[model samples]
Target: MTDPCGACGARGCEELFHGLLALDHSRAEPWGPLHGVSVSCFLLQHPARLPADGGAAARGLLRAYLDGGLPAVDRLIGRARAANSHRVTGRSAPGGAVPPGREAPRGGFAVTVEEVAQDGTFPAAGFPDRVRAWAAATLEVWGPVSP
Candidate 1:
């Protein structure tokens, strides 16, 4: 069936994809639904499922935009790199391998800032509003949200 909200729409989704692409494996996984729209974070975390570099870059930008800069952005980046990040993965049901097209659920990416850290402050200045504006722009480019 066609995606009810055209979940596969190519516009804003591209931005989202890019956002995912740029994310190093260290960021928080907000892999769940936010108001019915799914942010496919879990998919991006799997080595086999990671999007291409270009896509990853876009996703990185989106992620950076969303999560806000950490108090120590450079330090976090260093830690993540030094750790030699691992692709996140999870096993399927007992004795069940992951299905080809149905790996992780679709709703695991779109995290809010609070969910990503204990410190309740933004990284870059003027962040939260910027993210909101970015998301709104994406939604506008994609189409209006469904009721």
Candidate 2:
């Protein structure tokens, strides 16, 4: 079998993703406000799952949430939608050095999908709180944003 996921060290990463998807779908109302931050946190931890432009966007959104909470994140998403561009591209320095604020963390996150799963499934009353905690913990592990 392939090695465990580098980010979360989870052997069944795909299953975890599917479980998250199910949670999102079944708990749309509760998950709505936290969706962007949740996805951003997950993507930041699992960098390989993100596309080239996605990394920067995910980091931007996560930083926005941490710095200004949901309102700030809403503003950013609004601006992107208004511009008809949701993707945020990263810029590299002269010698191919990645610009600050553009780099994703290089190791496993402090919180993993496994930990979230321990809080129970989507139908469980505490699932939403668990997810919120997961996002917060993940962001905390990444530390402060460079920019």
Q: Highest lDDT among the candidates is held by which one?
A: 2
Candidate 2 wrongly placed segments (more than 4 Å) = 1-4, 85-103, 123-129, 141-143
Error of 1 at 69 (Å): 4.3
How far residue 113's Cα lies from its native spot in candidate 2, in Å, is 2.0
Clashes of each: 16, 0
RMSD of each: 13.8, 5.3
lDDT of each: 0.32, 0.63
TM for every model, in the order presented, reads: 0.25, 0.67
Cα lDDT tens digits, model 2, 63-117, are 6776677798888888777666445454321111124555656555656666666
Worst 10 residues of 2 by lDDT: 90-99
Candidate 1 TM-score, true structure as reference: 0.25
Query: Which residue pairs clash within candidate 2?
Result: none
Cα error, candidate 1, residue 112 (Å):
11
lDDT for predicted candidate 1 compared with the true structure:
0.32
